[model samples]
Target chain A: MTSADETQQRPAGDPAGPALDRFYTVIPAGGVGTRLWPLSRASAPKFLHDLTGSGTTLIRSTYERLAPLTGEKVMVVTGDPHRDAVCAQLPELDEADLVLEPSPKDSAAAIGLAAAILHRRDPEIIMGSFAADQVIAPVEAFQSAAREAVVTAATGRIVTIGISPTHPSTGFGYIRRGQALGVEGAPSAHQVVEFVEKPGEETAREYLDTGDYLWNAGMFVAPVGLLLQHLAAAQPELHAGVVEIAEAWGTERQQEVMERVWPDLPKTAIDYAVAEPAADAGDVAVIPGHFTWDDVGDFAAIARLNPAKEQDAMTVLGEKARVYSDQSSGVVVSDTRRVVALIGVEDIVVVDTEDALLVTTTDHAQSVKQAVEALREKGDSDVL
Target chain B: MTSADETQQRPAGDPAGPALDRFYTVIPAGGVGTRLWPLSRASAPKFLHDLTGSGTTLIRSTYERLAPLTGEKVMVVTGDPHRDAVCAQLPELDEADLVLEPSPKDSAAAIGLAAAILHRRDPEIIMGSFAADQVIAPVEAFQSAAREAVVTAATGRIVTIGISPTHPSTGFGYIRRGQALGVEGAPSAHQVVEFVEKPGEETAREYLDTGDYLWNAGMFVAPVGLLLQHLAAAQPELHAGVVEIAEAWGTERQQEVMERVWPDLPKTAIDYAVAEPAADAGDVAVIPGHFTWDDVGDFAAIARLNPAKEQDAMTVLGEKARVYSDQSSGVVVSDTRRVVALIGVEDIVVVDTEDALLVTTTDHAQSVKQAVEALREKGDSDVL
Candidate 1:
């Protein structure tokens, strides 16, 4: 039911919804999302799903969210299997900007490849790489943050939009913001002290208590050349490979180069390959993102993104889902037209698809992958 | 995939395998069974489905369990909706012995009508009324106990097979045993002091502590005339209505009489109309049954009856069900070919049907009816 027109509409006179003459938005759309199995699968990843029951799928929403700032300067990097789905969801997308990977790689290769291609196009253009499967609310706030990050990135710093921690969540990595950068057109810009791994419960609580930490949402706004420079230093082989592919991109050799070299690229998340190392070298800047964000990591996160329709009751997704919840508080994501009835269960998560069904609780949402693993062991590849 | 031939095999030379010339078996196959919703619907009650994956449906198993003793004298009384399914499951069942009720009625009406009809056929013959949805193990033991009950019932007493309580369960009613009856060939027969209602936990524990209590599994064997005599005394209106229907049975007036009188018949469980009243009048006898029995009351009881296939794992029913359990223990009753995967949740219960799916836990199995009630409130009658 979602309209693609939402991605084309630009708010007038909005501080960040104006022409960003030399800024491009790169969307890295990859992730098997096994934790959301049955709803999300290897054949069709989470980015292609409207997990929140929102009209648009996650990737479509991402495209629309970033469209106003980048206009036609948007690029989506995805795996070969999702090429048609991504194109179908983003009809306005230019073929020249849609990067289809030969196979899945880590965030570093995906984002690095996009940056290298953008750098080859225009060395001075500032590019922001955002993941395709995350959800953010109050578009204006995120746009304002992106505007600030873009402005801060113009000062030769790799800027990242850090989300203010809503809770002491141990599932996400933490970004420590240091002194204010005092940069032009960016009041919230601060120097990054360090990028920390997911913390233990005690340390996370401490981080929340001190209020000096923000969740590293893996959003990067930097001059394409600066990101490529950092990538070349931290992951030389991956950088060389993506650069080799980028050099032939849009040429007849594009698919040939990607298929030959993509698989051997060093697989690493963008945080480890660039952000963390650059933070250690004092070459990273942080822009606070006041907007709500979630990676749509698992059913638990999906429930958070799509709050319960009734207070403390349930969050249900799917256009044709007929769910009757009685004395139950949980999440139900159904793709089929079947009626799902839940009674007297708290914090439960039920994912119903045409071929498979998953039943667990939010407490075990992270363990959903264990079921997927078991299915793989049993050679139930049809479901996988 | 379950073979119906299992319902025809009779153990040769078993003590209760043959030669009960004047006995008949009455199988009462009724009950909406909302607690097992999606699996057992109002259209197709629990007795019509093979719930235990035991190669025979509940009613078919009940029929076969008593076939050795009663031979061709078994009569099944059910609502109109299940006529075809019942006949399909039991091809050997004579059409003359199949009694179809026009609508849902209480046990007193279903079994009492069967008893009244059998009374009209041969009042001197002993008749046993057994619910079609229960499960019993060690058929020989149950048959022996039933043999004793029939011999004891021959002495003009209403005999109930009282299963020895294996645990302090508050779900089933208790039958308090008094002194031994000392009847020949019925060595375990005893006087029933009373038939108690389902007790509270504390009282049930107390009943278990003392060995005088046995679970009243609603199995009653008696002379056809004796049960009707008690029924006529305790519930005169229901007795008259069924007796009127029986009078016109097998004639052109059969359907006309049942349609006119069945709906308005006094609705009452047979236990209240006969056994409890007979016990009060010191006309009831108890026969100790040393066999495993389960009413398949709810998912919890179902999980117990169909124990987990793997240790501390799960119990899954449905021949085409593709289930992968990982670090989870639960019960899955599927009627479709869906792959049901469970993660870390324990004691979960999932029922996947073609149009409806139910997710709960054994702890809340009884509350499944609440979902059904909610669905009814929403006027979702098609799935109901």
Candidate 2:
């Protein structure tokens, strides 16, 4: 593996200047997206879908959004099942930059493996990890915030881009910002007071009223060495396992080591294993991001992102001409070639797939996962 | 043409004695069933569907219910397009008994033509006309009512089987009953005072409270000659056209006369052309039916006929095993072999077919026809 100091240089097309020359984007692309089924199946999850009807898949959009800042320094860590799909969707990504996990070990192992690989290649590389399934609007604001976060991460603190809350959302974890860091290159950087789990509606409303809390978008930026150090201190076994895999990543023994050690790695989110513990130690910082962001959590969230042409018409995510609706409102994910007719329904969510069909309302979007579970329990794996 | 005095006799399966010996059933199997939409298209309408999950199509169920009383005396009157489907569904019907119309000329022409042909075959034959799409439960009560209606028709009056009201439903028209007829064999028979159209909720409630009104289920029984005489007096042109078609029915000129006269015949319902006017002329009698009957007008009616196993489960018209529902109600007509999962929807109507899908609620079931119209307007006849 070559070091950043020896191989890294400002790309000709990079408009962010040399300040971001050493920045690398690591995208953790994995999630079953159970709530979005039958559109998002286990074999083809949400990250592989062009959910916004924008003619680009979510992973492709993520790659495009970060390409300007990181140039060719983008790496994606996905499960083996989705490895080919991710590569096919993102043809611009270098084959060497695609890290395929043998099996899911949650966000902790997925991101930590990418961090280990980046650290081995360039110890000084400032890596920012974004989920492949999120939707971020107003690219300029995200770029500005990411640049500032990268600058702050160079100062040896684990940093996260906190989305400024626009509503009292109980879906995402809340990050409480304490005192201002007043860092020279990053003026918006603040000391993360504490990280809290997803709260109840009342607590979320209180969080909005307090004006001190930001939505923890699960986006983190840090020097590869610093993130690895936190991981080593908090979860030594997981850290050591990833380190071994990273060492063999570019060698002939890569597949052999992965097959032996991958499944044994601890299954945990990075927040519980690193960010929370690091925040408790007063070694965490946050950059307030003004850009809009969403995990595309459910159909209701998808409806909000893609508003219907008319208030009463459904917002179709596939071929709009195939849908015939009257006095209906909400979202329709139509992947099938057949016509979908919605009449006199309100706030409905209809997902028409080839082998399965889902009909529900926006209010019960989260309960779709229960249907998936029921199907699995019934041994109907073909649909799942 | 032979008369009933020479042809009518007790068949091998005749169970109602000699009074019903000359009785025959005429089922008018027309109507596109537009409100059911994709489940009931113009090519394959609702009459051919097993909407109640009873393992029998609506027309087949109609035949099975009346077969005990009429034996092989049952006749189906349908347009040329549905002739094959009606025959395929009802294999027991004699080829001579299936009255195939060249084109749709509405109820007056269809039923009047059937009556005209039956009058020519057996002038004393008492015929009862029932819709091919209605669901009549507790066949015993229907048999008893029809027996009384036949006896009342023998008294030279146009008798109708009126469904006793179970609720203040505004869906069906009300038939106001007059003084009870002092007849021995037909004790429940009463003189029909008048026929009223579908009323408002308050008016329906008032009618229900009066105890003198029964739902006009459009079930009429009369001697073939008496019905023709009423049609001849009320709609002379339509009567002449059907009479001309009937005169040529069994001859070599059957096809020629039908093609020439069927399209030009007056398109009017029997209620307007004969029944309502006959009631004003003091010739219509009413036999109150105690059996439960539904026209299966829409998904709401289907839900009532096929109640869900659990309150939260969907009332599926197809294979219930293919449906996975949670906190959902109303009905689902799944013709496709795909799994349908409904979550958090209330009173929803989801009809999944091979070429189209319909998603709505029971309240908006009537509006499904609008979707079909819209699809037609958009030149999406493939789905319509």
DockQ of each: 0.65, 0.71
lDDT of each: 0.87, 0.88
Report the poorest 10 consecutive residues by lDDT, candidate 2 chain B: B1-10
Model 1 misplaced stretches (Cα beyond 4 Å): A1-19, A52-54, A119-124, A155-157, A164-183, A188-215, A225-257, A260-284, A307-312, B1-19, B165-182, B190-215, B226-244, B272-283, B309-311
TM-score of 1: 0.86
Question: For model 1, what fraction of the real interface contacts is kept?
Answer: 0.90
**lDDT tens string, model 2, A109-137?**
99999999999998888899999999998
lDDT of 2 by residue, B139-248 (tens): 88997898888888888899999999999998899999999997667999999999999999999999999999999999999989988888999999999999999999
* Candidate No. with top lDDT: 2
Backbone clashes (count) for model 2: 1
What TM-score results for chain B in every one of the models? 0.93, 0.93
